[model samples]
Target chain A: MDKQYSEDSRQFVPETMSNMRFAVLVLGHGEMGRSMEHLLSGRHALTFWERNLEDGSENIPLEQAAAQKDFVIFALPALPHAELAERIQAHISDHCICLSIAKGMDEQGRTPAAVLGGVLGPAGRFGMIYGPMIAEEVRAGHPGFAELGTTQSDVYERTRELFAGAPLYLRHNTDVIGVSWAVILKNVYVPLLGAAEEAGLGDNARGFLATAALEEMARIIESRGGRRETAYSLAGLGDLVTTATSTGSHHRQVGRDLVHCAPGDTCGTGMNVHSEGIHSLNMVQRFGLLDLESFPLLRLVRDIVNEPRDVAAKFRPFLDASFADAASRNTRD
Target chain B: MDKQYSEDSRQFVPETMSNMRFAVLVLGHGEMGRSMEHLLSGRHALTFWERNLEDGSENIPLEQAAAQKDFVIFALPALPHAELAERIQAHISDHCICLSIAKGMDEQGRTPAAVLGGVLGPAGRFGMIYGPMIAEEVRAGHPGFAELGTTQSDVYERTRELFAGAPLYLRHNTDVIGVSWAVILKNVYVPLLGAAEEAGLGDNARGFLATAALEEMARIIESRGGRRETAYSLAGLGDLVTTATSTGSHHRQVGRDLVHCAPGDTCGTGMNVHSEGIHSLNMVQRFGLLDLESFPLLRLVRDIVNEPRDVAAKFRPFLDASFADAASRNTRD
Candidate 1:
């Protein structure tokens, strides 16, 4: 540690834990990655790399960047996560902190944690950052909240301390599996909120879906050995509500478009729109990690997204089926 | 059972268990009561009564209505529930089903269930109908969902059967205390969402608040011997999101207004608008049912509503304190 010059006060200060600057490597130059770079550049020794390297001056080789940093943030989409981790595997120090901000499933329906386990192996100190902090909002200095889910307590502490002076707020929990599933599944549920909006169900439907979605998510998480309460935390219920209601979200747009589009049709309004929820549904179905029978709402949303025609008609059967199940449960009890 | 005339077909049908109609007494003529009447009138023999007798023809004497009816639906505000229940208690049939649709704490912080117990004793069969069913939406024949919380299985079954052909969907649960507390406490948390919106915290804040509010409500409910999962159900999280985000909600409006109003101000823009959340806070403070120490968000919302001022300033401390607690917890773990 060395004396660091403060941009605000224009004076050198002796290094303290709060002001300790780490050599940080941020993967990708996307919106989220840039936002992280902006937030961390002034306080830390920051380096960035993008696959294409549009600006070659600031870019470094992936291996070089991975070997030199105290922290590696995966800001790329989940689809490329495993590949990227594998490419940089040999270069990453065992003690280097690895965190992911990705909130989607890979094509194989592997969560970021699972992908990391395959890529980084058990030797690396790793975790993830997931919650409701949108990149633009974070860039604007709006107060943001996130959860750090990792198996290692020291990893959580180091990650927590890394963002100590930033506008972001972080909470640490050891339920990595639970938090990972919550973040991954929220992408699958947000589009249903959009479908509810398209159906003119009003605020009441939004409220109903909000709770119902969390309960359904809880069942799926529990089936996978994740805690049910995690679905009620920032990573699950919080992120679901936020993403579902987000004004410019792609998944919500897909829902609105799916309502108007014919069966087996891509939305005419966008040239190549890819909804994360649609991708998630495909991956979840492909992997079959959890029983689909218990998740009526998820099945309904998946059906709607799959056919994307006469959404209301598609939804009614789901309501009938779920209520029928409830009625049977009532009788059994 | 005799042959019953079907309203839709105008033909007589042989009696079945499902078609057995109850003598239903509706206690209010408000939007909710009207909606219920619209839903149940065709299926059952319906009676109406109001203390003021705004409509003379339909209004029956309180004693007559109470004695003859097999079901008494309380659609009035929580403030009037106890007194109304008491006035009609002696005249009520021993086996009459008593149901409340009110979702607020009375002046003494007593939930409608507690008030019913105090007024009706153990003589009357009691339960509550609560969920995300907004009156206007239900009136429009929208699919609605609710939880019927009762002690008796027969009561739950009968209530479920009463709405068998209607758009209202019912689920039975034996956690009457938990469901009652969830519905009551939701009103107290809805304002926090409004406050978050007023602060321009974006969907992230909404997500953060949604999870935080439910967690706080769960703690309170659990402290009072109510089940924590009840807060995640239709009665709690569902209704809270609906009410908090509802465009026409007075409590949400109060939140936005409180942000702009001066200390000790009643939003000059509106005339004598009373918010249920404000009333709820006062009552909760009066009752001291749950420890307020764990509920910083509730306290911040209460303080803002009690004396509308710089809401952002008031909320920042709460954010700091909670994050500090989370960080310390992370380290301790």
Candidate 2:
């Protein structure tokens, strides 16, 4: 057997027979942080780092939490990761394994895992957990699939061992960069589906958006030095379907409200909503890492967000362009 | 430029500038057939063939319609396709192109297109139109994406030209076999999703099922001499999502009723329903063309349909085994 296969097969032990445990620290009290807390309840020793205590009790400091645990989960927003990683860098143990659940882009277009790594320096170990996981469902013990992306093979084994019986089934991978790009780009592309719904484009519209968006995402990921297939896995296609079609998605609501709001209305209900997608687009525009000419759908969404008027009218031309683009690709050998 | 692509690119004319029409014959005036009738309105000369009209009007005979049209569309179920194709073979015009929209398998596991080909003999030129088109939505003038899969590149060009400005946007491809398998296998895989919903499995369950099912589907398509990427296209993922999640799908209804029915009840509400998925599963079991070991989810669905008690209990072991399989694959590369 190959050396890598033997190491990987070792982590496949059934949960009932495995008794591995770890001291885990979660760095956020947000919805996802709480969900992770619920999932890890009895299987590990838990510690939390929150900025403020709601119950009028003092919380553990971030540095202290960073120093003690074998696993440190960063469930905070993507924006603060670099700062927090820097602050906790001196205190973190050499053996600590960092996992980021934030599926968002930084101002520099770096993923959460990248920001964490940038601050933690070359010695730090990190991984990203991403997929179709909704916080409420995870808290309720509903089954979901996720990918654990890390550069270090031993980190993958340790993370798998820790979540041996957890409801979140984590598949291991070394393509941390690919997972990061796919997860971030999925958020950026999902809003156009909502715009389709608001335009009364029907379910077929969702189908078109899914195929087209994923194809473009794979191309962009490939252009950026990540594997294209990563965009087809649980992190990209699975989460895009979940976020785009779910009536509860705030990002989707942004598109709906943008179209539904009257032309003169500047401040609609969705105007103030936190959309990581819009931020990601802005970062994409700034970075110019990908050729925007390749992605008609992403360009359309960006245009609509900038000027929310006559969505259906604007989208018609976009559709024509996209169909032409598809025809070109389809006939290519 | 390559000769094939030049012809395809010429067919890629924008809807605004294109004005091409053909005499179209639609076989079987079922819901989908009627929807095609509606979509083709004002764009072409139309003829319809139904066994018996509800109004008792004298409909055009099948043979006459076959001989008159430039395009002959068989929109009937897969089982009836062989008989219909054989009956019309001698009458169909030598210049006519055939398209099949039926997404079902015959008792011998032949797809609708395959059945049509088997009866039409070697000289017949054919294609398939498959995607997320729900009949009612098409009738209501909703836009939908579909692929025109044919080995003849000119046939693709001609078909695209005919539907240039129609609500049904057609993309061209030469992978007829791949599209046929993708469209057929999607019908077989969609019912399990319905079963998932009826079991009170949360939306995350849908996400997990979507990712896992498509992975297994691509493998099955590849094993059956079809391109695995076909499963990622509109014909597979697009149609599967539409069918599995649509409130009106009868196959989904079959799964829902099966789980909700009481024990010892051989005849549930869904017992009388004609599910293409159920028929496809039966055919698969008989043929044994693909290894059942590679598809745990498909096997679990087949098992539940055979005996519909305790969905979660039966599903747990399947998930465990799947995770183990995933772990093994992850370690290998």
Candidate 3:
């Protein structure tokens, strides 16, 4: 290398790392995954293991594509986040930085971070990008943005710098657990907010629901060992607001799922997504794990999800719960 | 007064102000304003003032509305709040408590709490109900809630306990400024998320935007003496989430404002409604007063709001931006 070139090279991490390629294995490729491929494509050598590929190679082993790459990203649903971590842990180099972008709580009503952390050990650099950057916007190269978070502030900066070259807008932070909690917990409420819209409630109703959801989620996350403000930041409050208001959020879709059925349908006509809140809500309620101030939204969400089908009529009363009594529920002793 | 009742009330308050007949007057009958009324209704000798009440005549004069309503609640837009305060000072009783439920940065982008505190004298009981209760839900007997704060914690508790009745929840804290700032600033970005959704973005995009808005709003609120954790709590986090996701949210309506040509036009041709973000976004771009992490969604909203009618094709490019490196606008630092 020339002297000036050598000096510059020493300063900048080369786009193409010699002997260390990146295997961008996107498990879901639903919407964000394909776009993740697009953003991560030029960073290093790229190969992917999309569960739902364009053709029908959903089951293709990661070895075929991820065999030589140094970095692997799990851009799938929470369902496979832990399992993927286990499989990836077997072959991934300790030096490799692994990132996950899924936003659902896991089977134990824990954030994907909790489970992912358990599976991946405490040493690997785990990074995540979350916020309002939709997959399509990212794929389209319109400066859609997200916050990059990780335990390793240096790694968070590194990952942010790595993906910063892409067309998408990336905000940097060092709160991977916060980001994980935000993405995971927000999943539960998004559907509920979406349903509220489909239920024909006005902005006031939607606003109230989303706000309460944040309160409840924050409380729950805090109880579960997450920072309260972390949830309040871009990860928690910001993401939830974006999702609840978005045109077609999965939670909104879930609300729609509950709406199309008869009023007697308990679980919104069973058309709802199988969300973590569906389980978390029930667990919280069953365990009476929280005070009245926390998790009211979660209780409602659980009631709507786990009950057989008559959730519509039960929830309808809430909508009609009398304007005179809809006083503010501030939750103080 | 019944001795037992007074004694019962004393349990919730300090001995100094237990006997004071708190005349709480609520200005504005919109969702938040009216929600205040709902909470304050049976609890105190509350009077309400709706700004555009074309027909109602049970209304009192502005002097009377401001006359000694122990708590003077300004539940209107940002522009009108300060004006209301100016007019309120004359009719204000010797020790009136001025509270606000409005969630907007003032003309100077100040939180309602600070402006109220500054205007009401340094010792005024100027606090606010900052939370995510939908006005409809609040009025409808659904659980609409908020947090109350004051430089005077005793005054905070006085207001807190006054409305601590059934169905009306109140969270108590001393972060009056933080809660107020969070409430107003979050509204700036809710609609921006709506536009992104209408533009056909996905969960990642919306999540990113929502989270970013929270972070920005929290910072703005914190800069003005509000707590970021409070923003994540019921008032800040809960309210924002509810507002953004609520189908009837003004913030969410920002999307419809831009997406539909007419208010009722659902064909996705053009939008109606002037989202606060469109206004705030322009302010952000024009003033550069915000950090790089401020509301991008708001910026997009402002862009569309200012766009000429003939450039519909240009707006449609959001969908294709990511695909074409069009989303990359920020200079890499």
State which candidate has the highest DockQ: 1
lDDT per residue, candidate 2, B127-217, as tens digits? 8999988887666566778877777767777777767656777777666778887887787677778887777555666777778888888
Better of 1 and 3 by TM-score: 1
What DockQ class does candidate 2 belong to?
A: acceptable
Candidate 2 vs. true structure, TM-score: 0.91
Across A257-332, the per-residue lDDT of candidate 1 in tens digits comes to: 6677765466622312376666777777788876677788878876776567766556566666666777777778
lDDT (10s digit) by residue, model 1, range B179-267: 98887777767776777688665667788888888888888888888788888888988888787777777667767766778654566
Runs of candidate 2 with Cα error greater than 4 angstroms are A1-17, A52-58, A121-123, A267-273, A328-333, B1-17, B53-59, B121-123, B267-273
Superior by lDDT: candidate 2 or candidate 3? 2
> How much is the lDDT of residue B136 in candidate 3?
60
Best by lDDT: 2
What does each candidate score in C-alpha RMSD? 6.0, 7.1, 10.3
Put down candidate 2 lDDT per residue, A149-258, tens digits, no spaces: 88777787788887776766778766778889888888888777788778767677678778888888888888888898888788888788777766577777877877
TM per candidate comes to 0.90, 0.91, 0.65
TM-score of 3: 0.65
The list of candidate 3 runs beyond 4 A from truth reads: A1-65, A75-97, A102-149, A152-176, A194-202, A219-226, A233-235, A255-273, A276-300, A308-333, B1-126, B130-144, B152-170, B187-204, B233-235, B238-333
lDDT tens digits by residue: candidate 3, B1-333 = 345423322222211123344677777777666666655555578777765558655456777777857777787766577777887887787767777766655566555666776777776667777776666655555555566666565666566556655344455666776766566566666666666556544445555555556655666767655676665656655666566556666667765456544444442223322444444444444566566444343444455555523223333343233222311332222
True contacts kept of 1: 0.66
